[model samples]
Target: MIARTKIKPVLYHVVAVLLGFVMIYPLLWMIMSSFKPSNEIFANAGTLLPKKFYPSNYTTGFRGFGGISFSTFFKNSFIISGLSTAGSVFSSACIAYGLSRLRFKGRKIWFVMMLLTMMLPFQIIMIPQYIIFNRAGWIGTILPLVVPAYFGGGFFIFLIMQFIYGIPKDLDEAAKIDGCSFYGIFGRVILPLIVPALITSAIFAFMWKWDDFLASLLYLNNPSNYTVSLALKMFSDPSTQSDWGAMFAMATLSILPILLIFIFCQKYLVEGISTEGLKG
Candidate 1:
């Protein structure tokens, strides 16, 4: 039995290591290929280590396309993503607090409708949304992409609502006895305790907005207004050919913020959906 237990753990770890390699192989290839000379990319595709790295991929990506600069793309990405996250998190927290805590007529119906809205796919509404925004003169502006964050996005609302529901009602009752209003209880009491859920919501929102290509493409026509994802598309070409090396480098760069977000919030993302499922 002792021997079997030891052998099982060793086997498990070996399997885990193999799976890890499989998962990371693409990213490793992308990073290494970013260093290779454009000619050798296809020839030496099998190797984990590139034979020669044209470090200029990094340099060229920054100024590779005319004088456009990667910095401009980075700036647009950060601005849109940061504001959207802030707007989503704050608005979602506030709305979720009310939905999960407050007592009012027709609240059940409203909650059910919120869940129904989530079930609806964005594809179904895209045309109508585009038309509405276009008529409002928001087509070429960042407004369409950024403004919706204030209304509390569906997913974030649901996430924060789960966190709010997990919070014990006794705490709110106690706060009420201590002369706290519902708003105060939400702000000072409930908000402080659900930092994990808040961070989780914020991280998800940031990622959603940052990596978004469709909305950015649809809303912003000018190359100067492009987000990193839209800008990244500039790397692809038919004639002179897309520099896979620089493209991979920029791809890696694009995912960095998302990776950082998960690394930072993962410590608190420990709680699961069960915590959110409970109701008082």
Candidate 2:
């Protein structure tokens, strides 16, 4: 029995390690290939290690196209992601608080509508949204990308509502007794307690906004306003020889912010998801 138990754990760990490596292999391959020469990338497709570490790919990719540098793309991505995330988190928190804590007629109906919006895919509304933005002269500006985030995303609101629901109503009642208004109670009492959920939402919002390609492509027609995702797409040319090495180099660089955020805030993310209803 003891021998079988030990063997079972060893087998489980081996399988887990193998599966993890298999899942991450593509990312690893891409990182390794970035160090290779453009011509040699496909020539040694099966090999993970480059024959020589060519750092020139990073330089070439950073130079960017049409006189616009990769630094500009990076700055634009940061601006959009930062503003959108801030708007999403703050607005979602307020909306979640009202939905979860307040008593009002038609509350359930409004909540249902919000939940239904989550079920609708972006493609269904894309054309309508584009037409509206075009009419407002916002198609070529970041306004189309950043403005809507201030209205609160359905998913973020839902996540925060669940978190808020876990808090005892007594807290609100106590605040009321202490002469606090609704807004004062929300800012002073509820917001401080919901830090985990807010951080969780912010992390997700930032990562999604950072990696958003289709939205960036749709709204940003000017090369100067292009984001990292858009800039990466410009690396490929079907009619000519594409610089695979530089593309891979920039692609590898693009994921660092997300990786670092997850690594640092994963504890809060896990806690926010798992401990919501358990809190009194």
Candidate 3:
């Protein structure tokens, strides 16, 4: 029995390690290929390690095209992601609070509508949204990408509502006894307690905004306004030899922010997700 037990754990760990490596292999290959020469990128496709470390890809990619630098693309991504994250987190929290705590007629109906919206894919609304933005003269600007985030995303609102549901109603009653208004209760009592959920929402919002390519492509026509995701697409040309090394280099760099955020805030994310359903 002792021998079987030890062997089972060893086998489980071996399988787990293999699965982990399989899942992460593509990312590892991309990072490694970025250090290779443009000519050798495909030539050594099977190899994970580069024959020679070519740092020129970083320089070439950073130069960018049409006289704009990669720095501009990075800055644009940061701006859109930061604003969208802030807007989504704040709006979602407020909406979640209302739906979870406030008693109103048709509240269940509104909540159901919000849940239904989550089932509708972005493609279903893309054309109508584009037409609306074009009419509003928001085309070729970041407005189309950033403005909708302020209205609260359905998924985020749902996530935060679950978190809010887990909170005891006694706190709200206590705040009310202290003469605090609903807004005051939200800002002072609930917001402070729901830090984990808020941070979890912000992380998802920022990562999604940062990696959004289709939205950026549709809204941003000017190269000056291009985000990192859209700018990366510019590296490929079907008519000419594409610079694979530089593309890979920039791609590697693009994921750093997301990786760092997850690494740092993973604890909060896990806590928020695990505990949100405990009461709800």
Candidate 4:
């Protein structure tokens, strides 16, 4: 019986390792292809190792398509993602605090409306948003991508609300007794306690904004203002020869930032998600 138990755990771990490899095989294939010469990439698609390590893929890819360098794309992506993440985290926290603590007329209605927004698909509002931004003269600029983040997204607001609800009302009452105003209570009492959840929100916001290709494609008309996602897409053309090696190299580079962010914040991310569940 003990031998069977030991064998069962070993069998389970073996299965899990095999499943993990299967899931990650494509990513591994891409990384390997990034090191291969363009000609050998398709020929050796079934293998995970390149016959000859070609370092020039990174160099050629970084030079970028057209006259614009990838440095510009990286810079633009950083600016848009950083600003959007800041706006989303702060605004969501504020809106969530109000919904959780404040009592007013139509407050429940407003909360319900906020929840309803999450149910509405982005495709439904995409055209309307484009028309609104176009009329506002913001189409060619990063404003369309960055500005809406300050208004608080539904998922983020809900995530933060769940965290806020976990806090004790006595803390708010104590702050009130200490002569703290609404803003002061939020800033002093609740904000410090919700750090894990805030980090979770920031990580999510950064990843979403960084990987957003569709919005960047639609709003950004200038090649010089293209983001990493757009720049990578420019490497391929159906009618002509595509730089598969360079595209793969750039694609690998593009995921590094998000991977680093998740690695660093993974502890807080797990904490926030687990604790938030206790409230709702």
TM-score of each: 0.93, 0.97, 0.97, 0.97
Cα-based lDDT at residue 172, candidate 3: 85
TM-score quality measure for candidate 1: 0.93
User: Number of clashes in model 3?
Assistant: 0
lDDT of 1: 0.84
Q: How accurate is candidate 4 locally (lDDT)?
A: 0.92
Instruction: Put down candidate 4 lDDT per residue, 1-280, tens digits, no spaces.
Output: 9999999999999999999999999999999999998889998788899998998999999999787888899999999999999999999999999999989999999999999999998789999999999999998899999999999989989988888888888888989999999999999988998988999989999999999999999999999889999889999988998899999999999999999999989999998887553331
The ten-residue window of minimal lDDT in model 3 covers 271-280
Number of clashes in every candidate structure? 1, 0, 0, 0
* Model 2 regions lying over 4 Å from their true place: 275-278
lDDT per residue as tens, model 2, 36-151: 99999999999999999999999999999899989999999999999999999999999999999889999999999999989999899999999999999998999999999999
lDDT of each: 0.84, 0.93, 0.93, 0.92
Quote model 4's TM-score.
Answer: 0.97
Question: Highest lDDT, which number?
Answer: 2
Ranking by lDDT: 2, 3, 4, 1
Compared with the true structure, model 3 gives a TM-score of: 0.97
Predicted candidate 3 versus true structure: per-residue lDDT over 81-197, tens digit per residue: 999999999999999999999899999999999999999988899999999999999999999999999999998999988888888888889999999999999999999888889
RMSD of 2: 1.1
